[model samples]
Target: MRPLIGLDQVSVAFPGTLALDRVSLQVFPGDVLAVIGANGSGKTTLLTTLTGLRAPTGGTVVDADGPVRLRGPADALTRGVALVPQEPQLATSLPVWENLLIGHGGLRGAAPGRAARARARALVAEALPHVDPGTPAGQLRKADRAIVALLRAQSSRPKVLALDEPTAVLGDRGVEIVAEATSRLRAEGGAVVLVSHRLRDIVRLATRVAVLVDGRLVHDAPIGEVSVEELVETMAAGRPASAQVTARVTGERPSGGSAVPRAREHRLSVEVLAVRGLREHGLSVDELTVRAGEIVGLAGLAGSGRSRLCRLVAGASGGSAPVTFLGGPLPSDTRASRRAGIAYLPEDRANESVFAGLTVARNLEIADVVPAGLGTLFGPRPDRSRTARTISEFGIKTASHQTEITALSGGNQQRAVLARVLAHQPRLLVADEPTQGVDRTGRAAIHTMIRRFAESGGAVLVVSSEFEELQELADSLHVIRDGRVVARRPPDCEYRELVALATGARDEKEAEQ
Candidate 1:
């Protein structure tokens, strides 16, 4: 079959980073090509190149019809190509229906007739029943926003679809929607290019798989020819491997009487934080606790209230939840939370956690120093020596402390954010999606930092969508559904069982039995 789109020896470079190097690939009609790579390995760059968001520095993009030069996203769209970005790109201020109608010319510009607008609304409603078309995009949860983006892209009916981690933030239902869309597109002879870290999704949706490492395509083969273990090994080693795998601890302690002593010891530990009557953003938790030196994980599908719960506990969200820290009543405010020795790492690190224009040292200092008012002569300055120490401790790679945080890669930026949060040495740490977009190395570093923090007598609560992440990093996990904790499992819980619990496929009783 003739390829619908092909990249011939493509190369893309940005300043110090060579994102993609002499990479060549093709997507044919009905082909679902999964692109797998570690963080910073150019999977996103490849998608951008194909979507015309970034033109390749070398090589040509050829369609079955002929060679094509894409000037911009619109040009690519005009040629029946569409991209669903990793991040939701909806207009937050606009109503959901308006956002969905953005590129379709149904509600804006030369406005379409009433019938056309109604048709668009019906399409969105049919495609995504969970999303309210009348709601403001910003008011909706993150997962809902992502769904809006997917529906918008699918509504275009592009001949070629490019999805960048479509299932990363989505729950089982969301994954089903995406899978259905892929099947429909394939049935209609359209092509798909998927970039994802979840090996399960790749195994389910991809017919062909391509591995990328250090900006180079290392392997390409049929999905049937490559196992999940092989993919993990290739990504971890950054090259093909033939060595036999060895089993490691599955993060579960021994059961029966052997585990009783440890469980009792943990229960007797001082409670670093406690919450009661917590309610915010449609999520409610009657009681939650984290003991000193414990790492607790909240696992749920997107929009299941995992992040919202974290924010509420961190005092970033307004709620009536009664919170206590270190046996004392805690006020529901950001400053109070910080003063009470609570550190929060928001999920939206790019915008919420880091100041892109500020120096790394300055960003780190903000954790300790508050900005002065107009009456004050000068604001607090960063302790240079302390900042230097933090840089080393967090393994943040930067030219200097004076370098802007935006200049670093996503993983480095995340590390900087973590370093800033940890500078205060809070008693409790609440991290949301800490390793969402980081590569294997970066994830290991972050995990190590979290583990070390807990080891140092601090309590940690992590909210993540990746089941395997929670399985590995969390000593205990809570599965949330519809804004409530439905099940609690040990770190050794089966991945499929955890998913089932989170999706409400099986209740806590059933899962336990």
Candidate 2:
């Protein structure tokens, strides 16, 4: 089969970094090519090069029909190519319908009229059955935002579609929708380029797989020819074994009695945090508890109330739920939550967690300000020694602490954010989608940190869309559906069983059997 698009020895260079070096790949009609690699292995750059967002410094991009030079995203769109970025670029303040329509409008030469608006509504109805088109984009959950971005891309009916981590934040139903859409596109002779960290997604959607190490394409094969273990080994080639941190179940007591003992140990294991009669965003929980020295995981599909529960517990949003921390009543406010030793790691790190315009040193110092009140009244200065230790401990890769947080990769940024939150050493950690964009190595580091914290006697309540992740990291998993936790399973529960429960494919009774 002739390739719809081909890259011939393409190379892209920045001032000090060689982003892509002599990389070549082909996208054929009706083919789904999966791109797999470690973070910063030029996967994003490859997509940008194909979409004309980044001009190749060397080599040519050839079309089966003729020679082609993509000037920019606009040019690529004209040639029937579309890209769905990892971070959604929607105008949050605008209505969902407007964002979807505007995305489609950019591809068409003619301005959208009343007829076009009607067509867009029909498309939205067909593509997104659960989403409300009239709702503001800001009001939608992160997973919903991703869905909107994908549906908008589908609206253009491009011959070639490129998706970056589309299933990273989506639930099982959302993944099914995307898979169906991809199959339809393939049947219609369109090509797909998928970049994802989830092996299950790769197994379900990809016909072929390409592995990139550093800046080179190290392996390429049909999906049927390679096992998941082989793919993991290929991606972990350069990453050291020590760098991959696994969760540990320790037997020794925490130093300095830092962790409160669990009730099973003959001592009263007090609940560090508790919520009762909580209600928000149409989701309600009768009661929830996080005991000291425990890691409790919330597992559910996207938009299934996990994020909302995190926000409510963190006091980032208003809810009628009565929350208590360490025997004290808690208020519905962020500052109070922190003052009460509750630390929150938001899901949308780009917008809610990090200070992108500031340096890593400054971002870390924000933790210091939380405890000192006005002690550093003149000007807040970061503790250099503490920052250096944190950078090393968290395995955050940066030129220096002075480097801008924005300049780091997704995994590094996540590490930095996590480091800052842990610096405070709060009693209760409320983390949502903690490893959403991190790669395999980075994920291990994060898992290590969370486990260490729990072992130290601190309590953790984590929410993750990946059932396997929860199974590995959590001591117990809570399955949520339609805004309520319907089942609680041991960490040894099966992934497919958990998914079935979360999606209402099976009832709790059936799951138990």
Candidate 3:
């Protein structure tokens, strides 16, 4: 079978770094090639070069027998290649079907005709009926939006399709939807390039696999030849021997200590997170206590007032409440909350968390940017050596301290962000969806890290929609519904019980009054 797209000794260089080194690779018709690697492994650069986003600084891109060229995205599309990014952008104001066919199948300088709309509707119905064709893009759930993006890309019927961490952020159902769509494309004679760190995806979807380590394609093998353990070891150790690969990324603090160093090390009990009139935001509960060294979880549906409760406890409140920290009234402002040994992790990491476009080392210094005593405005220049040590201390794998934080994998990014948050040495951490989107190993590591924080005499208040995660990580869970605390359960509560409490128990009189 002939290759649909090929890279012959392609090298791409950015300032101060060679993103891709004389890497030769190919995608054949009907192929599903899974790309696996640690962060900064140049997987993304490979995809960009393949899709014409980055020009190769050396060698050539080829087709079957000779050199091939791509002028831009339009040119790549014409040459049978398309890229679906990690977070697919859509025209939020438009209807789902219109968003799917927005930029394609239209007259030059005119809107998409009715036949195009009809075609998009039919295609979605036949292939992905789960996605509502007429719903506004802004209103669709995260998974539905992703499905729509996949359908839109396939709408063009390209010979070779490249996906960058497509299922990284999706749950089981979302992953299944994407995997099925990919299978359909492969069975229909199209080639697919899947970049993912999720081991299950590689095992279940890829026909073959390749591993990239430090900008080089180090391992290429048939999916049947590699065990999951071998793949993990290979990615973690580059060329594996007998060492435990899981230790490298599995939530061991860079500065190693016993797992429960100071078991249940409580400094003091903070009482009564009471906010007068917070009932306006569905915050019906007036009080809860989070003693130091405890992991207290807030579980509920998206609009269940958990966020409001978290914001109140984390000091993002508009007005001061009776909430006490270390036996004193907690401050109302975010800055004061930080100074008072509290840190808040926002739900949206892409926009609210990490400092984008900054190097890993610089992003680590963000917590210190808080102004204190009118002496330092952005903290000290951050001892360059100390920041570097912090990265090692967190086991954040990056090619260099100078590398952009965004270049790291989703897991590493979470670690870096958590490291930054911990920089404050806060007594309490208000974490929202602490392990979202990370691979299973990464997920476990993050959980361990959070648990370690609590074990070290720091308290944690976790807000999550992932009931399973709460079950695994929380010491105790508070279920919220319509802004009221309906049930409090142990960490091992039944899944149905938590779901029923959070979503069922609607009648106010029937709940905890």
Candidate 4:
């Protein structure tokens, strides 16, 4: 079949970098073609080119029948190509129904009209059962808002659907919904291009896979022919056996005592702030704590409130949760929590975390921009040259401290961010989804840092969706369900048992209780 979408030697350039370099790609009618690549590998640029938001510096982006010239986002939608961008900007002030309609050339039907109401309900039911059509979009959760945007796209039933990191904010069930929706679109003869870093989703849903690295097409093949590890190796430019080993060795600090010396070893310790009830999904945690020099892992499937719980402990949320540090209550704000020596690493680096436009130095120094007591009006105090040295000590590779944070590789960026947090030498670190989207080497480095933190009588609460991660790093595990801590296990907990708890699988022992 003729390709429904094609890119012939396409290239896109920014002021300082070539985003897409003489790259070519194609998608057949009804094909689920996934574009896989590392961060800054031009996946987004290629999608923008195909959707017409960006003009190619060279070659062309053809929609089988004709070229799609560079225009704005609206022009691309008008041409039957709808892009669900990674960050789905929504009109929060509007109702869910209105938001959906606004994306479809404004609301044609009145909100109270019978047909319009029914159509809106149908749209929500089909794409997002969790969202209320009558509710204002602003009141919805971030994930739910993303779902609404997706539904709006499907409502159009366009000839081509392009979703960039659609599952980034979704829970496990939400991921399934997106996968199912993409599959359904294929059945209707629509062309689909999915850009993602998750190999499992790509392998399961993609009919064909295209790998891009450094703005070049490195591999294009049937999904069945490639393994995720192989893809990782390709992205790294080779499958060297000792790559992980080298990273682990270099990342390791030293052996003062623990098996993984230099690994921060924290027994579970509690650092509370001003939070009451602290509820999001369903679980209610009242007075939580882990001893210092302990590794405590909170394991749950997405939507279990694991991420939210971590955020609360990190003092990111606005509401007050009565938190205690040591024996005394902490101040109700983040600044107070930090003053009490609490640090946090958030899960959503692209949104909730990350100051993208800042330089590596600036990003790392945000917490210390004005250390308390430097001056009430803000005056310089101690030199941060030591802090800069510590950043280098963490093995953060960059052209310079002034390098744009966005310019670093995903691993390096994460390390820089971590360095900033570590510079404070926090007594308690709450890491939420710390390794998501990082490479094997990056994961090792982060794990090493966390372990090292725990070793020095610090406390840690690690919440992760990946079971293997928790398994490798946690000395104790807490299973959370519907917003409650339902079970706890030693660090050597059985993987199957953990999985069963995460998925709500039960046996006779639980039934008897």
Q: Sort the predicted structures by lDDT, highest score first.
A: 2, 1, 3, 4
TM-score winner between candidates 2 and 3: 2
Off by over 4 Å in 4: 12-19, 38-41, 53-59, 106-118, 125-131, 168-176, 224-241, 244-313, 318-332, 344-425, 428-513
Q: List the residue pairs that clash in candidate 1.
A: none
Query: Distance (Å) between predicted and true CA of 340, model 1?
Result: 0.8
- Local distance difference test, each candidate: 0.77, 0.77, 0.73, 0.70
Q: Number of clashing residue pairs in every model?
A: 0, 1, 2, 35
Regarding TM-score, does 1 or 4 come out ahead? Answer: 1
The 10-residue segment of model 2 with minimum total lDDT is 240-249
Whole-model lDDT, model 2: 0.77
After TM-score superposition, the amount by which residue 239's alpha carbon in candidate 2 deviates from its true location, in angstroms, is 6.1
Query: Mind sharing the TM-score for model 2?
Result: 0.59
- Candidate 3 runs further than 4 Å off: 106-111, 125-132, 238-340, 343-513
Which residue pairs collide, candidate 2?
259-457
State how far residue 466 of model 4 sits from its true place (Å): 16
**Candidate 3 per-residue C-alpha lDDT over 131-212 given as tens digits, one digit per residue, 9 for 90 to 100:** 6777788887666677778888888887888988777445456567667877888888888998875566578888889988
lDDT of candidate 4 over 337-446, digit per residue (tens):
67767887888787756799888777877767524644468654435696579677887888988888889888888887777777788877888888777776777788
Provide the lDDT at 277 for model 4: 48
The parts of candidate 1 lying over 4 Å away from their true place are: 13-18, 37-41, 65-67, 92-95, 105-110, 128-144, 168-172, 197-202, 213-215, 224-313, 318-331, 345-350, 353-425, 430-513
Estimate, for each residue in 352-420, the C-alpha lDDT of model 2 and write its tens digit.
998989998888888877676765657566779989999999989999899999999888899899888
